[model samples]
Target: MGTAPVAVPHLPVGSRLLVPVLAATGGSGRTTVAHLLARGLAAIADTVLLDLSPRLASSWPTHLAARRATGLAALPPDQPLTRTAVRAACAVEDTGPHILSDSRAWHAPPLLNLPELPAAWYQLASIGGWQAVVADTPHPLAHDLLTARHTGERALTRDWYELPYAIPVLCAPATADGVHALIRATKTLDAEALPLARTVVALTGTTDGRLPASLRTALAGATDRTAAVVHIPHDPRIRAQGQSTAHPRPRTRHASTRLTDAVLSAAHRMWGRPMPLAPQPAALP
Candidate 1:
């Protein structure tokens, strides 16, 4: 008889890290950065990418609708929405060392009122060794403001101070025009949501070298809780591969190498230990 398959242990890492990546603007490469970060964190510990953009029409809506269709939606709306339901619907087979969950589908305006669901999902992910929860936040200031208000009113059964974990990583494109737009949007939101600033992640497109002074000032002016900037060069290689859901491609061998290095550096700054980088294949001709 063939030898029994080696039983691999579940939950590879000891501790979990939650990292939310949002954007100040819409096209600031939030999704790309979130994916990159998840891939990077996978090297050291288990990583999951939670896409929180409701507009993306991800699986969350379908799952929620299905639950309602099956008459399960009436089962105590106050109860936190569990991953059991979502996992079942999403058919998440690969709960391997790293799992990236796109949580954006549930961010719909209608779902925002369903506070228990998002909170419950987050809690479940935390318990499941989800080391990193990278979020691709929305663009408009209204989005953040509404989220904060709704989150407080609906999901603040726990200490209000701990809400930062649920906050997203805001991304702002690295163009003069984009940055200006983001500044206006963030400023308006900052008037009401103080924590909004902390979640901003500025995304600079391929540039010759260092960040520009104007963009730096614009980011500093924001009042969010934390800010991080990631620079993605304008590489035809990435676009040619069509990095979207319909044509998802693995990070290019060259990009993967640099991304791993950058992620390691960021991880050290954020989580103390630097993780091993993912292996890179030979560059394409």
Candidate 2:
């Protein structure tokens, strides 16, 4: 499908917003949510999409049709990570946010024995002068935290969730198993005393219409614990072709807009100040 240039919003005076979209399981639409959120925010401000998924499994490179393989992994470890260096590492998209993800060939040897710390990536993004950074995180720490046996390991993993600038966008599918996993994930967060008051829950619809009555009941109880819940409509194009830069259906676009508005609202309420308004795109008639 063809793409158009993404509209840039008027510059707003405020610290950059970091949105980390995370999920506990695969097929939870975490990456999709991150993509849409970044696209929406990119229309409102200068935004960057940071793909933190493992190199072999990453989708950003393919979805964005990035021409370069250079990304976070390509940055020289010895050099100071300045804004210019970070910008140089990104793959520019003609119709979306700058994408920073490992686009190396699948057959290439691994560059590092371990992934870079989340803090380092966040710091790099913070200094890049973008108004927002939408991070497609690998997975939630709840699962790893449950299996971790050592106190030090758990502490280090838990620290990843402690970013003050991050606004969490917890994603899950609108299905029985997905809802159940979300419950467990939330319970783990509560157990760790992590903040949820600023979280935005995204429930992606796999089928048409409302969720099953039983699932809705369970989801309602779970959603009540977060800042807000936004539903993503089922997009047949995406379901068939996977995530791409193709324009989504009207309903899906509306849902994405609602999610974006909710996130901005959460930021305003949390900081006790109104965020500079962006001229929103026209809603579906």
Candidate 3:
């Protein structure tokens, strides 16, 4: 009889992972993608969505504010508050083992000082026992603010690579002009910070399966290194749903779903583990 195969031990259900998804430009559907990815990751383990953008809190679900107040009230007056306060404030729509937080709310003028931000973030991550943190940050603004705080001791004129985390995802538009514009912008950013080519995932927005040939040619011509490209086809339901206050009906071909899959796939590859897939729900006709 053949010897029994050795079985490998399984990884704990929740392993800490930090993923930062950024846009080449504003309005590239970065926030939408970040939220969907958070929801999808929740399917696997406890996930927290941290939106570092300035206006993230205003657009967040209503219940989030009440939650923050409750958590804040519980803290001792002398002790510094952790970033988890932001997460506690958000009303979690699902009972799944996840906490989705819009970190943008924490970006108020009071929180702008760098000394407080990083310390708070570190403390929050340590205390929450979070399995993963998916952060959505404003392009240059996020990078600049965090960098200034991290290296406040150094002269501002000196070149420094300051960031709370590495950028793994770089989202861009699918149009030729968009790609060209991004390429130029990436070059400028690379001069100061890390290269965009090192991104593990590059998501492009498209209207249909048909991608612009010019954009394809430009990406091909460029020597910038990129791991993969995820095409997000335009879906009217996403926009139409956003127009109304009601929770938009989730659709099968929704752009968020595609974006989430790509992010999770990238995470799986990086961690060398299989990520659980979100259940597919039936779409309304």
Candidate 4:
């Protein structure tokens, strides 16, 4: 997707954030959460969404020249990475966030130490002053990062959760599996690492905006876990089958926008106060 990034004489002055959207199960709407989160964050920073998903983000480039953008694997194994290389590998989008996307990196073996290897490029991109990095990392990688969030400590053995104050956004359905996933995810929480003050977005994907009874009981009874659940109603567009039928649909843009707003509201709980969100982009013509 190698479209040049907006050039600046120097790195912008501001804080940075790394949001790796994760999921316990397939239908938890992980990709949807990622794209929406990226869009939501665009208003606050120069957002670079790393599309590590097997499939590309719907808004990313798929054109002739854009498709020629290189993947992470193409990075020189030894030389230091430069802004030019970073710019070359990513594609500029027509609206919202830009994406440093390379699906090939999805198959590489996981690296135990982060801020380097596969993540280094993007991590460096963040360091170079993009301000915000939202990675739609593979589920396995995402889940492993959750382990760091759950324990509040990085395992002595892995690179998970190495990002400072990294926000781990976990998406789950409103079914029995979502409940089971909720319990399994929160079993171990380090107050210092993952606090209960923030909001949790649990997308029910059901007509009624309610979680399953069992999951509700589990979450409600979780006195130690204070992260309140913010339920997202079912949007048929999220579950659409084909590329032609999916997200950004005019019929469901309103629904997706609603969810984006919920995520922004929850963000305030963790980040201290809400950052002004840029207006939602009109659907692509």
Candidate 5:
């Protein structure tokens, strides 16, 4: 979070934004940040949480009690997804963001890959008129990107990082090892000439109190390369119970609000205009 008070930034009317929760390591609190961002953003935008994690690894379906929804698998392979189709494939709850993720059991085989590219998923969300899409990208994708860069074959990397009006929230645990991994990932993205300037660094607290001296010293070197560096406070419940749709503690929500604000600040910088407020709903007679 920045030194100033967090300002709420709504999406400009008829505009959409893709906010991908990206990370270089697992257990860096990627999905939890994505969920919190989605829930917080839902108050101002038509938000959808796209759980791009593997089927057996997905948490939203179970957390939301939407185990039977089939999620991504329910979409037809031969057709372009319509609003109705996307809605049907999602775990449409009465509140919070709609979830579109693979909810299959641990033993299931690989599924079909229509909307083949990473950008295609964002397009589907746009087609469905979602104002915001928070994609919980698979953990391995970052490692793959780094590998591709090193191997001199990065043809497949653009769609994930180069989408129009997309904001990348880079997450990592607030630890010496975790910060080192994050720095490496950032350098990779920078070398590839992706929009690293628009990125947000989220340091998920692995423990309480001041950051480890080593981690602080590491982050100090890379602070200038990002939009904002926000600390996601460690939540004991999340650490103990994992992610669920239930409300988080107040401080956790505060951190989430800061992250959302940073994202909106980055979006404002990208688009260069003041965002319009969401319209008020009509009251019942």
Candidate 6:
């Protein structure tokens, strides 16, 4: 059921990128990877991270509270978000992209009550100076945002918002049901609906560095849409650190350091600059 680039041809200088880390299951570590990608990408280019999901128990913004100047709810729904407002509502990370915290004002349903999402996305896309944007998205908006993209509606206000974006789906590792559930979820987004260039699946929750044969086999069946498959080793530090506010640029724990590197490789591929000799992990089943 569940899930998984790179280039010497990089995005033009100063161009913006959005990498939305999504998940089929609620607690599959989507936010964790999103934060790591944001941090890693920040090392290469100016990055901005938007947390679109507030329902989760923990997130990067929560880990380090001082950076949170405000939440997404404060972005004035009636009008386009002003740059000043974006600054006020988001936690500004000096070394990385700015962050927009999740807001409870989200209303409901298919759109998860945050109907102003499209406009919010446009505002971020419109903002200049940022080279990358990483969004930790929930299930409801995945289809909506990609639908806009497929329909050619998600361009930045200035450049026609054709902002570059990727969708990383994190699925539970080792469980057939989890991968199968992911496969079922993939059925909802056909190749046309999915971001073929940037779509990737990461098998999370692992104690070992390798993935189980069963999970790998399932992912291989999704070769059509997935760009790659990666494994994120489980570490207690990541779990513990989730409770506190994190550095704007994430610092890896003792064991999870390699996990962060693996994720950064994924980020590089999604950005379209191929990693020369980048080791190809196992293919999705």
Q: Residue-wise lDDT of candidate 3 within 1-285, one digit each (tens)?
A: 999997632224445555566665666666655666666556655666654544333244333554443332233434555546545644454523233333234434443322224324333554555655666655443345346557774322112122222225656666766676556545545555654443544444546566567767776654245545655555566555541123444542354555555555555554456533222222212
What are the models' TM-scores?
Answer: 0.53, 0.85, 0.62, 0.64, 0.85, 0.64
Where does model 6 exceed 4 Å of error? 1-13, 55-61, 93-95, 103-113, 140-174, 191-197, 243-285
Collision pairs in model 3: 51-103, 51-104, 64-89, 64-90, 67-89, 68-89
**What is the lDDT, from 0 to 100, of the residue 235 in candidate 2?**
87
lDDT tens digits, residues 167-187, model 4?
556677777776676555554
lDDT of 2 at 110: 80
| C-alpha RMSD of each candidate structure in angstroms | 11.3, 7.9, 9.9, 9.9, 7.0, 10.4
What lDDT does candidate 5 reach at residue 259? 91
Q: Which stretches in model 4 have alpha-carbon errors above 4 Å?
A: 1-13, 53-68, 103-122, 139-162, 190-199, 204-209, 212-214, 222-228, 241-285
Q: After superposition, how far is residue 221 of candidate 1 from its true place, in Å?
A: 4.9
Ranking by lDDT: 5, 2, 6, 4, 3, 1
Residue-by-residue lDDT tens digits, candidate 5, 1-285: 769977655676677778888888887888989988887788778889987765566676567554467677777756656788888777755556888877666566877453446656766677677888898886554577777767876533456676667788888888877888888878777777877778988889977877767768778776668999999998898877767635667899999889988898898887776643322222212
Tens digit of per-residue lDDT, candidate 1, span 1-285: 999997532223444444555444456666566655555555555555554544344433343342232222222345544445533323231322233233333443344322233444455455444544554334344454456576764322121213323334445666787777667656644565444533434454644455579777766675334444444555454445433322233333334335445434444554355322222222222
Superior by lDDT: candidate 1 or candidate 4: 4
- The TM-score measured for candidate 3 stands at 0.62
Report the C-alpha displacement of residue 240, candidate 1, in angstroms: 2.9
Error of 5 at 214 (Å): 3.3
- Report the CA-based lDDT of candidate 2 relative to the real structure: 0.74
Best prediction by lDDT: 5
